[model samples]
Target chain A: MTTPNPTAAILIIGDEILSGRTRDANMYHLAGELTRIGIDLKESRVVSDDREAIVEAVRALSAKYTHVFTSGGIGPTHDDITADCIAAAFDRSIGVRDDAKALLTAHYEGRGVEFNDARMRMARIPEGAELIDNPVSIAPGFSVENVHVMAGVPNIFAAMVAGLLPRITGGKPLLSQSYRINRPESTVAEPLGDLAKRYPDLSMGSYPFNRDGAFGTNIVIRGQDGAMVEAALMELATLFPAEEHS
Target chain B: MTTPNPTAAILIIGDEILSGRTRDANMYHLAGELTRIGIDLKESRVVSDDREAIVEAVRALSAKYTHVFTSGGIGPTHDDITADCIAAAFDRSIGVRDDAKALLTAHYEGRGVEFNDARMRMARIPEGAELIDNPVSIAPGFSVENVHVMAGVPNIFAAMVAGLLPRITGGKPLLSQSYRINRPESTVAEPLGDLAKRYPDLSMGSYPFNRDGAFGTNIVIRGQDGAMVEAALMELATLFPAEEHS
Candidate 1:
């Protein structure tokens, strides 16, 4: 019996990203990590630091997917409204939790930094939520319902995902193999489609690349079964002949 | 009397992006262009090339926003199902249009390449849709109702945006200025909030960065009015004092 893959959606909350002030690092990092761990990253949304948008997105994503991972807006500023928004989405009360506060306090004291009111806001988490660790910074992320909220900074977000993903159950890891053909995508699309039809369970993707004035296509075959993936890759290698590109 | 700003949402369609095989470049480029043209980019979504998901997102975003821009899935592959999904979204008939076919024919003929069936698939356009130009490659993108579908490749997407944006009416360009302060966000949050309240029309965003073991914040002030943006920047500079950072 095959267990279906657990699906995830990512909600990126920050005005900087939507306004083009910052190129997102967290979404790309999380997508790779989730894919590796057998959790299918189905969709990702980027919304500005608006309260209503955040709450609405959190509610919708948490309901539709097995997990909803959010990055950004959990900071020490007025615009950092994600924690409150998450609580509002789930209709739960939120305030500074003692455990979270103690963690931040100890870290701040160790670093000789003042744990001011704004910094203290980091400890504010929804009721009945478990804290996700932030090894880079002491401020903890939290998982409320199906939603996991993490810091926007790339390093901190990566650290949080490392701590969080192991606890969640995932299905068999999706396996992928690629073959590079020096021919254009148009030349490869027809035969590739036939190959795809023969193996209905696997997904085939053709990504075209132009490197140093030479056009080529990277065709990736992906599926949950390793033996099936290997079989498909072998067929693709025979059809495309890898030595042409090498 | 102030007219409301036109709002837009971007739908990025591809499995490579969701699977972390490719980092997205189109969303960033589109966001910056939309911001410059005074269209408020309210939301952006990245979805894998699943038919139902694509159709649902296209319908929802088109209904809610002033304009919806979609990138990706107009290629010569089996997984390139965006055109069909778009037709299903609007309940329109789609087939290879003569204009699109002509363009691709000329491009391939000029390059001494075959204009085969797979390449001809790029010419398919939904009924009552207008073609968006693709100077990078000859395949045309299309605009149906408020939805504009463009190529996903960065260069082609950028070129299409250049060709398409000028044709649409835009509001006053959103003006912005940034001041980098060599202080933690905790140190700057209180006064920044006060300053934000003083200029309610402008938006204040505090982006924190940690570089080389030192922490700092970049405060960005944005609004439609140049005068309001300038005023906010002046206050921020005086409050933070760039000389301190220097």
Candidate 2:
């Protein structure tokens, strides 16, 4: 058993999200992908397109987790200050890198578009950082220290993650099994609590839902060991003795 | 003009969210509502069901923003440790409150169900805290210092926000206007940057979207002053000289 699973945190940077104008897709996508690969997504944060807030979040999350992934604010616009803020977080210098510029230059040139100053902003990278490939867009994401700064756009973000995840070392993949009880959480809380206590290694989560006036709880058991998870699920099933919904 | 709008942060506590099993609804709901009432939702964080993480987030967010709203972990289950975490963050004692217990008791009794010990856990409140009414469920949310602890369910969280927002004093409602350019963000970044600099009081946000293989940007200008926002939008229109989409 891997004693300490690799942990990660996501930092979403965009005013559009904070203003409730855009529903976040990056965090949700990253969470599922990270979990499938055995990295525990311990925390996630969404901050506006502000420099101080981004820098502060970067420093804090980077120090706390084994990996930190940031989405948004890497666009051509003036509000896209993520690159500079990330640099400040690590006390590193930032400038337009030739390799990143070459990628953007070739893509734009092939498309018969001018590589203007705004577009060139995409090439800005912190010193001593590795580039993360963006297959959808030519603008590349960068990894400085433990933090990976990627695009905010969902398609581009997804492409970058596909290229990046396999490079990072991961522990045992977390396996989860859930049982849906047709009773309210209040009915299952007591016995479920005891079941959780018995299997201290696994994580027990109860999600209550009200579906068409019928209240129910979806109890999920997560751990690295599938055998332990199966045992706990059996105990939970015996304790509840209800028809399983899932 | 309200020079500085009231700022807020949301701390969502649940393992289901971090594990990617649940898509968050409360944060999006609160963000729109807070923006409508002129409270800037500056930052939002999702932490697991760990007590240390919950306490740390509560303390950090409460100090940074004028208001902090928390969702989840207030339920009857053992993983519902948010109430205790809130108390610990502020160095206060927490226990079942009479008023809160009475509410839950009447609710369960009306439904012809027993108000068991687990159900009574919903009545836990921190010292010197005020209850936020939950019309959907009898479980009450509370506000201690600047932090407001609310439920995780979408409906309950919305109802609680409806009841809570009116009581808190708010500045002028934030007004916004958007212009959609058929061109990419790279095309609109330069002129929009100028427009933002011209009207420094207004917040300029550019959101890029790809619809049916066509890329476009929706430029939004927001501020307390409607006239300033309108003026900025007009300048933005002239700068772009294209058909407005929004």
Candidate 3:
């Protein structure tokens, strides 16, 4: 039997998401990325930028999951309190590390801008934390214990994730396949239920839809074992033989 | 001083969301709707279809928030165990109620389809629960205790929310205003910080953006009092008057 993969939880730290002023792109993007790498994303939480809230969520998620990836609250603004909260969560002291400060110092000086106190806020890191590279912007995200804290901006979050993923050793890649049956979900449930029981390890889901007054259900089968996923999909396809669309 | 609004938490129940097969729209939509009515969305969670996971999340969220809204896993399939799980969370007895079955029975009969066991599964709501109307489909969502469970489909979820929200008593309507400053967030941080401190009741956020190599920050001031939000925006405008977006 294949060993179980590491479980993860995403802590999205922001008021914009909670207030619904901004639609969350970081969680969606990170979910897909984590899945491809076989790190099971068990759950995700979105909380506001409040200090107590951030600290509580960080501690709770860190204790529950193998890894916790957080997006937002790691910028150079007074509202950006993720770094300090992370330190408080882990009971570690946080200050401006010389290395992180140097990166920002050079980035600002090269652009003919002063590395002022407001800008220097980005260089604050918790003690014993490793820096996460931010290629899009010079200010870096950091990894403290099992939690990886990153920026809230879409492009910078994506870039930091791209650079940090290679450092994480993932389990077997998750594989998936889908079949669209031109029938209502009620009609498709019988076979799909039997199919699910037949392959206990695989995950099967039936999503119903209506298109131009025609009802349809998309049955998706997902598993770590590629052969088992293909076998189940083949069995399902034979029962409801139709044009193939993957 | 205005009374604080009721707090909410969203528990999204589906493996599709956790596994990255689906991007969550319900959470984003609900966040915006709750804000308009001044039901503060404190946090949101996305969990898999596992029974224990669903039960744990429901109980935790229900205990902490004034209302806990759940979306997905209430369908005509084996994987649709949200009804049973919600019952388990509250320790309430669950079975196919006559009224719910009657709705499905009439619905299927009118469409010339049999109301089979799979379809009957949708009628299995918890004891002491009030049914929430579904306009798009005959299958009804329900509210047991403080948790309001609804369908996961975008259109149906929106429809269910449209019907369910008016029943809730909300606080004062949340008001907001924004000004886009064509300056780096670091430059805008000082004034925004002072503004936030001046109006401790209002929430001010500085969202940084890089538009075609030009740095800018959108300063948003939000509060339940329209006059307070307006006054803050005016103060901000006087400091750096360029243009108003919201």
Candidate 4:
């Protein structure tokens, strides 16, 4: 495992995601998983199923981040061209692999479904790619070079990622602490601002919410150093005189 | 309104959005809205509140698309720094405009709340910026040089976009239709594959969902042409053998 901070970026593909028809649960789940593994999620981009756009985004993200995890657009449908776009981006030939075919055949056999041509298309893998296991669905997501491509359906995506993430290296796991402040963001900005200056490493964010017609805030403190996060929490505690101090 | 096709992009900026704590509802809402108005949503990107990232995304998107609507990071808190980022990107100085100050001042005064420095920070606009009306909260989201920066909160974002969308020129509105197939995607792939060959302008997609412990498929047809989308739908209907049709 490399010693330096490992950064990962997620490229979420699909017109559904961009259109808001699907409330993306994968990003949050992946974020928590990446955080636990000490990976800094430097960036996440949502792009439609347009092949050229997908190819361009994949190239930009894959080149910049240590690891690139793309969710969605890997199905058998026409819009499911993420695998093809990824292959094009990496200059890899798109073809069916024996291993992926075997996995899909076994999965379909277990379900008592026919291993037809459309179903077989899921077995198409970028040349020289390693399969990422999908426990929920038999057709697996795949990883090539540094890019991991997975399903768009939340559960399948989560399962595919769960199988893949443990195998990769991560950075210093960030420690996170949050407390709800039953006051407007204005009420806490100054002290929170001061605390940020004091804990330069910690990323302190104040999210204002409207609860029961009364304004409240959730102050989130995040950093690689647990002690610094706790110290920031202590500083935040002094700022608002909050009832619940975590 | 000279329009061959109106094109728009959305820039969602928030650590919360990137973290997945906040499922981005605005992207969907805005995408649907733009589509309804005949504006093709060519691209959508989500970046964190990092000034450089925001500036970079804005500059790039603003250059590519006709209109760029951004949501998030326009609030009283320091992390709400989208305004500053936009100002920096456009090489314009940030200043509290008299109009924004008056609106905030009036809203706060009406509510009997103190319009302090933090609250006043909401009034800061980039030079040469035109304010997007926020009817929900007095704090307005602004548009500077083809970039419309709105609030990240769904309600405010929706409200601002509603007020702003009608003013812009939209191209031909998108036409869409869908039908469910009782059979698996495997059964219909060959025919759908052949159909896709005939309709080059239309985008066709099939989503497989597990219902009653069996796989069911929903085929969606989308395109700028209304008659073409309906024609494709009819072709799909004939191919699928729908309950009503047969």
Candidate 5:
């Protein structure tokens, strides 16, 4: 049995997110993708455009997790300083990159948009960094050490992450299954606890959800081993029978 | 005019959020609410269930922002140690509270469900903490110092936050207006930049949005004064005319 120690984390930066104007859609997509890649995402953080706060979080989480991903604040606006702050975190300087510039120029050329000074700012990369390709938007994301910096906008960031994932070293994806039991967590806690103890590798969760003014619980079982997940599912099935489809 | 330093921030705790399994819905909701309340949401962080991570985030954000609201890991599961970790951040011990016990017991009684040991675990509160009433579930969330701990689930967390907001001190609520500019950000950047400089107290944002297979931009002006918002909107209208609903 392999130890589940291959870990990853994310750091989301933006003041727009903190004030609750835009609901973040990137976290779920990243989570599902990371799980499939077999990287144990152990932590995530959201900080604003503040340089000190960004530097502190990046330094600390990078030391703890094997890989770190950040989203947002890497734009042309004055508040967009994710790249500079990351460079500071690693004690590096900010510099323009030839590869990133070429990509940005090509991207704008295809769309018939002039690559002006404000647009050129997108090509700036941290010193000694590798670019993460973005298919939707030509402006590339960058990686410094263990930290992968992606865009804040959902469409662009999601596309960028998709293009970048295969290159990273990841473990086997975790197996998870959920069943909606129309009962409170209390009704299922006893049996679920026993099942969890029996299969020590499996992580069981009971989330109580409200649907149509009635409460129900969804019990999820997750584990690295396919067989272990199957075993947990079998026990759950015995407790709550599957609904027959007509 | 006040320095407009009514500060607030959010601390989201969960491996799921960082790993990208759950895209955070709470951050945007809190940001919008705080903005309306004139609390400048300066930072947001997503940390895992690990003790040190949670402790560090709570300590840092609470110190930086006037109010720090956290969501997630307040469940009955073993990984749900938000309460304990937060208490540790404040250099306090976790213990069962008589008030929480009474509230939880009454809540379960109304639903005709017996409160077991696992259910009672939800009643654990940090020393010298006040409760944030959860309207959805009877299990109360606690606040010690300026750190307000709410559940990770969106619905429950939102309800608790709505309940807790009136109790905290807030500055003048911000007013905002948005105009859809058919042209790209480039066409508007120069004028918008000039407007931004002219209105030092207001924050003018030009967001590029995709609508009906064409790229459209929303130029938003946000500030505490309604008169400032109206003045900015008038200037922007002269630059980019509104779509006539003829």
Candidate 6:
């Protein structure tokens, strides 16, 4: 059997998320991006901006997965302590690196903004970490070993992923196709279960919905093999023939 | 000193979310609700619908937090294995509990639908577990000790939460106030950090935004004490002095 694809975990460090002040946009974005790049996103965790919590999760996820991506807490505020936590997790010392400082220094100085201590905080990269280019913002995200520290802001996060994904060698891209049936999920579960048994290598998920008082289920079949996914979708489409509005 | 409020963690079990086919709605909904009820939402984790993963997460979160709310994988489909995992985690024998089976039976009977084996899967609850009522859907979620296993569907999960929250006693509701300053986050970080140090009990988070070619920062102050939060917000207002368009 072929070797299993590389696995990944996301560690979202933010008090804003845990406190419910902000709904997560970063996790969703990264999950989709990672899927597109063929990296299996195994687990995602949102933790408060507490040092112990951040360090523990960082170490655990880093050890468990092929890659551990972290978002939030890399900003220029006291609450932004992810860089320090990552350094501590790997037992390395953190400091304001000259290269990182130069990037921010140039960006701010060009805009006539002072590279103050607050802005300089963004330049605090862990020792022996490579900078991930940020096209949206000047403050760079860093990657130390297996952990990729990214900015939490949605656009910046997306930009960093764009720059990072191309550098990592990913496995086959997962292909998926979905079928919508105008029946309740309970009615379709048995057949779906049988189909799942037939295709043991593929994953089938049924999501139910109630829209305009009509009960319906959306069946999504996914696998690394595009032909298999297409065949399964074809079989599903034939079994649950499309209705007028389906 | 006040007794610490009960802490909670959200465990989202769904392969659909891990694959990025679906974004999480249940976690965000529960997070806000728990925040309002004075329950500290310590962490939120999303794991795949694998048995070992679910069981390990359930055992870990259940042990660490006062409550563990899990969403997804309790549906009628074959992929739905949350109830089984929870049972296995707690070493409880699981079968079709009569009370739960009867509810689904009657609901299906009333609607003139046959309650087949697929539908019967919903009634499988662990021994000696309290049923969490799902008003929207007749299939009941069960509470195995501290772990509350709910449906993956957003509406069903929410209905179960609405029924479940009333029974739990929460501490003082965490109160929060926010101020929008036209200055960028880097510019406001120093003062916001100072304010955070002054009010050790409160959490201060500065979220930066860019809209209409203008950059601004939204600073949120949170604490269990309402008056203290008010006092801090007032002080923040005085320090920043809200601008006309702010």
In terms of DockQ, the best-performing candidate is: 2
What is the per-residue lDDT of model 5 for residues A1-246, given as tens digits with 9 covering 90 to 100?
Answer: 646757887888865566566676776778788888898877666676679989998998899888999998776655567899989999998877888989878877888888876676678899999999877656789999999999887888888888888889888788788777887665666777777888878777666667666766777777888887988898898887766210
Worst 10 residues of 2 chain B by lDDT: B237-246
The per-model DockQ list reads 0.82, 0.82, 0.78, 0.51, 0.49, 0.78
For model 5, the superposed segments whose C-alpha errors exceed 4 Å read A107-113, A239-246, B15-21, B239-246
Model 1: per-residue lDDT, tens digit, B1-246? Answer: 235689999999999999998999998998899889889999999999999999999999999999999999999989899999999999999999999999999999999999999999999999999999988777999999999999888888999999999888888778999889999888898899899898878889999888886888999999988887898898888988877895
Model 5: DockQ vs. true structure? 0.49
Cα lDDT of model 4 by residue, A40-81, tens digit: 777777778888889999999888889999988777766678
Query: Which residue runs does candidate 6 get wrong by more than 4 Å?
Result: A1-3, A243-246, B1-3, B244-246
- As a whole number from 0 to 100, the lDDT of residue A6 in candidate 6 is 90
lDDT tens string, model 4, B1-246? Answer: 223676778888888766656667788788778777777777777787798889999999999889999988888887889999999989999999999999998998998988999888999999989889999777998888799999887887888998998778777776778788877666667788789889988778766666655666778787877888899898888877767322
Model 5 CA lDDT for position A8: 84
**Worst window of 10 by summed lDDT in candidate 3 chain B:** B237-246
lDDT of 4 at B41: 76
Worst 10 residues of 1 chain A by lDDT: A207-216
Question: Which run of 10 residues does model 6 chain A get worst, by summed lDDT?
Answer: A237-246
TM-score of chain A of 4: 0.92
How many pairs of residues collide in each model?
Answer: 0, 0, 0, 3, 17, 1
Given candidate 6, what's the lDDT at residue B4?
A: 79
lDDT of 2 by residue, B151-182 (tens): 99888899999999998876677899988898
TM-scores for all candidates: the values are 0.97, 0.97, 0.97, 0.93, 0.89, 0.97
lDDT of 6 by residue, A122-239 (tens): 8889999999998777789989999999999888888898899888878777888988989999999999999999998898989998887778899988888888899999888878
